[model samples]
Target: MPVSHPDPIWVTDNDTLATYCTQWLKLDAIALDTEFIRTDTFYPKPGLIQLGTGQEVFLLDPLKIDNWQPFAQLLGSEQVVKVLHACSEDIEVFHILSGNKPAAIFDTQLAASYAGLGHSLGYQNLLKTLLGVDLPKDATRSDWLQRPLTDIQVSYATLDVVHLLEVYQLLQQRLKPMPHWNWLLEDCSNLSNGDLYPKPEEQWKEVKRAWQLRPRQLCVLKVLAEYREREARRSNVPRNRVIPRGSLWPLARYMPDNIHSLSAIQDMRHSNIRHYGEEVLSLIEMARELPGEQHPKPLPAPLPKAAKEHGQRLKRYTSQKAEELNLPVELLMLGKILTPMLRSRLEYGLFKLPEQLQGWRRTVFAEPMVEQLNQPEQ
Candidate 1:
């Protein structure tokens, strides 16, 4: 059976939004979400900001209303918990609009994972799981930037937050008694604390097949990637739009010396060559001039045959521990985190807890994991 929902209150002007924000400040929690477009830009183009305080839903038009100070306060207030689901991109929207992400957040997708309901549940699936509500999917990709949004678009946006408050309430109840309750809060707090802009120098680590490069080649890649990162932000364009990833590795590998050499690399666009050819060559020259000792250590190779057996042991131990705790293995210890730890162990001959595993995971799994590795094979 279909359920009826109230029409979302549309707040387009400054005063109306400020008045409602004052009212929202009195609430214990609010459900929040955003609709944005990011097809070609470095930053997301925010179209709509949704807020539900249980009594009413408000759709704040990003195209209108300049006053975000009151709402920014509401978002940052430690008194009110801002509930969201899968909110990484939404955090970017909030930061761009209001100048800060929520100071306090209860991410339902993360909460559900901790509550043992499921991992990475979509908003629609979560609503179905908790409230038996099936949302229409037709208007999901609608042109939100267009004015006079269709009635279908409005309802779809309204339905998004209507059930979210209820979901937060239920998840909170489930989490209240768990031993890892504080761990969840700590993790949620980090969502807002994370730096919005990553360091440009470290961007080289993200290039495809980066580990294949020699140390000096890595130094060149690092310099070029840093330039790309800075230029992408400066021009407000995608990184690839600044320079494609495919072209970057070859530039480092060949150590292209001039515009002619730079242009010869596969996937190197002519516009990039024309626009940035001189600057790119200068950065490569800087890398070449750096002393051998200044170059980064060579990227670690694949695990040796001996380390492969140890990695399997670590994997089996982590799986068994996750099962015992009734925690999702992916949540408890992701492969990204595990691989680095294994690499450090292979190099140092001792298990090293990664910085990511420093919190509750260190408390729960660190000792046991080390013990499992230290024990002789049966």
Candidate 2:
């Protein structure tokens, strides 16, 4: 049966929120979820925060409630375990709300993944699969920022957290006997780390076609992406609003030195070029003028036929290892994460494993894989 709570009390101001959070701090655990919109903004526009304390459900109107400091304190309190699911964006909303991240969180989705519930499982599906309950997801596209949310919206949002406590409890029971059961706790604790979001200076690596750019072109793309990230943070607009990413590679490739040359780049919006005209020109000119020694290292050429053959061996190794452990291949190490390093080793004879491949992954697969990674294909 679906768990039921009293009709959610709509808390629109600080005093009620303070009262609720005061009681919430006394609890050992709570279920949490957020309804937010990020359609046109760099930062998510918080609409509603749905909190479940096992005994009660509270719907906090972030638009109307200005003081979230108490709830933020509750989040940071050592005793309270905040339960959530697939919570990366929810962390962002909480950060914007109170300048704090929830500490001691249990991500049921991640826990369920380990419990044989599968990767990236949705809350509704987990409920159906584990608890035999069907959760309605009708209000998924509702405008949460709009006031006077309909009954369906409230019901949908409330359902997001109401049964989460039940799910968390069931997941805990299911996960308890697994070999790496504690891995969920470790992964959950790591989620609270301050570096969950992308660093602006490091954002350039996420751009498409980035690896194709040469040393100087890469330098230009890096600086341009950094500028856009910082600008998005400053103006609270999406990065694409500043300059579309596809436009970046061409600008770097052509080394557009003036407004006219920039205009010739197919994707650079004319209005954006005019607005940031001088600044963009100066950046390109600076890259062009960099001394040869100061230029970044050249991009490695494509892999040779022998290197391509070696990749097949790596793939077979990953599949065999995953089968032995009875874990998803991705949980071992994603192809994107593993193959890139292998390619780099073949291309430049350099090897650096991704930070994510450490801890449990290192013990299981990484050590053996690294030993054979450099061996010629059999």
Candidate 3:
């Protein structure tokens, strides 16, 4: 059954937004969603922000309104539970807008992962699975930053929050008795902390093929990635527009020493070479002279065949644990991190478990995992 949606109140001014904020303070919870564009920019350009408080749905235009302090205050307050669906980018929009994140959020997507619905469930799918309402997603790729949003665009935005209220109620009821409820909240709080957003200095950890570089090359890659991050933010352009990943791989692998060498890189755009060639050469040269302690440790080789087989056993154990708890197997043991954990044992002769295997997992699954890995191959 489709729920009735209130005609959305168009919020074009701060005064209207302030009034809504006041009304919001009287409520115990609200659902939020944002529409933004970031095709050519490092940060999301928030196009429209939508909110639902059971009785009303409203659209606030980010292009016209400058003040979000009142809304920010309400979001940062413990007085209300902010509800969202797949809120990682929405959190970024707010963080960039108000310099603070929302308090006590419930992400429907994350909740579904723990609800045995499926991992990373889509919004419309969740609504259908829970409420039997299937909403059309016509504006999935619309350019929201444009002026004069069509009726379809506005309707799409409204649907984003219309069902969130009921979804939260249902998920809460389902989670009421589960011990992993705290785990869900913990994950949501971490998303709101903006900890997932890495600093420019730490960008190298996410670079593709990072482990391919030796220590000296690793130092160069780090500096180069950091430089790209800084420049992308400063210029407010896409990171690839600054320097492509294809360019970085060769430059790091060869450890180029001069502007000529940097220029000769196959994928370095002529524009990038013209602008940043000398600086690139200088960064690589400086990295060559850095102290050993400053360089990163080289990544060890992949695990051997026997250890790879043992990883399959560990995977089975993780799946059984997840099944017992009604959690997604991915939540308990991420295969990406698991690969490295198995390789870590191969190289270090002991477990160097991933972060997921620590914390709550240590008590729940890691102890058994350690025992399993320690036993000799059968």
Candidate 4:
């Protein structure tokens, strides 16, 4: 039988939030979710937060509450597990609000993947699959920041956590008996503990066509990307607002030295040219003057056609193993981890295990993956 959930309590002031948080601190686990807008800012603009204690759902208005110390302490309490679905963005909102990441977290999406439910399953689908509940989708893009939320929007937000608590309970029953139960917790911990903010120094690697640039050219792109990242954060604007990413590659390749040359680059906005053209030229000049040793190491080129067979073989073996284990292939052998391993073997002629593959994966597939890599091409 489906459980009848109570109406969500609206939390508009600090005292109510603190009082409920105190009671919630005593619970073993709680369901959590956040509603935020991120169309134009480097940081998400939090609008509402929803929490479920298995008994009642609470809707917290970020615009109304001031003190979050009590909730911060609850989030930091290692004894209590915070349950969320697809928690990456929610983690960011929590950190921004409380200055603390949940000490313990269980992400239902990841949990479902581990349980062989599906990879990257949407919350609505997961609910329909596990609990036979259908959620309304009308309020997904509604303005959550606006005051006097519509009744439909409020119901949608409340159901986000209300059904989540049920999902958590169902997944717990399915996963607790499995050997990989702790693995789900481990991955969730890594997700929450990860640095949500982008690092300026490493930002260049994300630019499209960045690998085409030579070492010295890469240095110029690196500095330009760093400047854009820093300026975006400082001004609370999106990265492209500072300088369009499409312009970075051309600026690096052409080594633009003046406003005219900089302006000629593709996607270079007039505002960017007028504001940052001088600094861009100066950065490029400084990069050119840098000694050879200071240049960034060259990015790896694409593998030749003949070498691709090795990655294909590794993928085949990994997919078979994932099937045997009743898990998603992506959960077992992510391309980000596999591609770097293949590149290392090609360059150094020896397989080096990446740190990401060192945990439960090491126990499961590490030896076989290395052996597969060492196999000679047919």
Candidate 5:
């Protein structure tokens, strides 16, 4: 059983935060989580920051505080280890809100996977598995921006971080006996670097199958995607609001030249066309006129037989190894990570391991994978 503390100090102002910082500095590791709404806005509006230090939980109200210097310093502090569960988005929030990423981070979800718990385990399932406590799901959809949050909401939010400290401690203990602790540390260190925040525009090409389009379609998509990215930021609304994902296929396929043609496209509705029609048409025109060499050629699809064989082999190998280790197959290798590696090896006749497959990963996870690949078929 875990101890429950409900006396969370709600720090709303600088004076209160300063007082809290005095206490916060004394802590070695703090569990952290954030509540935010991103439905209406392009970027998430952070409503609350929940923190715990093995003793108590605190909810820092972003709506009330004007200065977050103390909070930023705490995140950047070398001595404090900030713990979070599946913290990619939370890290993004910290970067956007505090303009600094934490110096030390321990992501419990990642640790759970490496420790053979499971890959991408839901927080609720993880809590129950590790702590034997069932958390309430009622507040999952609550309006975090609403003032005077209910006791249930507060309790739910606080619980997110309160047990995180204990979970981290438990995972650390388990990982001490495993060789993958160093890999987890390296991954966590990379998460703390904040480099993922400012990705280059060309990187968007990797989204879905943007690379599969013809050169002309690729040109149009590149331009439209760039436009969408800029517009999403400028309008402070979600990218989907400006242009939905379904609309992209048509935009890339037709590469329409005028508003009339763009509006007539089946995927784009008249109302959306009327709203963003001219801009879309203009972008298409630009792509059509783009320099020939500048247009990206469609990447050739892999041979059907080889592609199918490699995928089956990789899946069988990973599944068997994961079963032997009592770990989830997905924990051993995510499809997103495996697809590219398998494709590269089959096509290029060179096996360049994914960055995630390197370092301690190669030792604990990749060695058996390589062996499985080399084994002759029965």
Candidate 6:
């Protein structure tokens, strides 16, 4: 049985947290995790933070305290490594709540992928696979915001960080003997930078089918989406409640000029039309008047038979190489990575490979695969 630390520290205020941070800076690394919910709003509501060094574990009540300066300083400190598991959301939370992005990060999920354990291994699966311990799943959906958290809830939350530290230590030791340690670190540090979190309004144009629309349609969709996002933020309501993606298509397609035209459209609620009809129509009118190529053409049909054959050849070669390495083929050559290159090879003939098809991927898998594909069948 694993030894338990009965007296886990709980910091409910800023002053006590400051002292903890001062002490935490002395540690080599800390394991961190967060509990949050985003079901009702655009942003996550941070409930509790579980942090563990080798000697102690802490549960921080984010709702009770305002200042996180000391914790932020520790995160910004290059001396201490911040270890987390599949921590993309946790990283976002840190940025949103504290405005501090940790400089040094070690993500166990990334490490696991590089270690050939497969991509996106769940936390419980990882603990079992690496440590031979079966964790309880009872608290998976517990209401974290409720006060006087049950002892079992505390125990479950504490284990999230406590076992995380153990997993980090083992993975670090295992990865220390491998060639991809620096690469993993590079990737983790890149993830630590939070610049990618707050996506700009115009960038939403990249969503699927946005380019397929006429300029007027694109403009209408953009305005509706922007309104939905802004209203979601202002009202603290879910984006779908404000305006569903389903409604955007018809509005953009038909370009309704009034509430009657809008109401005639399917899947639009009468109450919603009464409330937002004019605003929606006004946006459509603005889009219709925007001067440019009004109607854009649809995307070209999929590649022909000859192109598909080449793609198959490339996929087969990559699969064989992945088998030799005992790794998942998708890890080395995902569909997104291969599709464009395959299409280019078919259309353009023997082009210089993309960067993704070069480097470690190429040397380990792509180059040999390309050679095999080029060789004529006996």
> What lDDT is reached at residue 95 by model 6?
73
CA RMSD of all predictions: 1.8, 2.7, 2.3, 2.0, 2.9, 3.4
Number of clashes recorded per candidate: 0, 0, 0, 0, 2, 0
lDDT of 4 by residue, 1-378 (tens): 343456889999999989989999999999999999999898999999999988789999999998998899999998889999999998889889999888899999999998888999999889889988877778998898999999888888888888787788889999999976988888988886789897899999988878899989998988889999998999888888888989889888999888887888999999887877788888889988898888898887777675587678778888888888888888888666777777777878866678766667777777777876677768
**Per-candidate TM-score against the hidden true structure:** 0.94, 0.90, 0.91, 0.94, 0.88, 0.85
Candidate 4 deviant stretches above 4 angstroms = 1-5, 372-378
**Quality of model 1 by C-alpha lDDT:** 0.86
Off by over 4 Å in 2: 1-5, 302-305, 344-356, 371-378
Error of 2 at 48 (Å): 0.4
Name the TM-score of candidate 2. Answer: 0.90
Segments in model 5 whose C-alpha atoms lie over 4 Å from true places: 1-4, 194-200, 207-212, 320-327, 354-357, 362-378
lDDT of each: 0.86, 0.81, 0.84, 0.86, 0.78, 0.76
lDDT of 2 at 277: 68
For candidate 2, lDDT tens digit of each residue in 88-125? Answer: 99999999999999999999888877776788889888
Tens digit of per-residue lDDT, candidate 6, span 1-378? 453554689999999999999999999999998888888877778888999996788999998979998889998999999999988888777877788887799999888887788788988888888988777767867778888888878988888888777888888887777656765786787787646334435433534556556666776776777776776777777766666656776777788897888887756787667666777788778867877665333443456677777777777777777777656666677565665676667666752356644346656666666666656668
Backbone clash pairs for candidate 4 read none
Higher-scoring candidate on TM-score, 3 or 6: 3
Model 3 scores a C-alpha lDDT of 0.84
- Candidate 3 residues lying further than 4 Å off, grouped into runs, are 1-4, 194-196, 257-260, 291-293, 347-359, 372-378
Error of 3 at 371 (Å): 4.0
Candidate 1 least-lDDT 10 residues? 368-377
Order of candidates by lDDT, top first?
4, 1, 3, 2, 5, 6
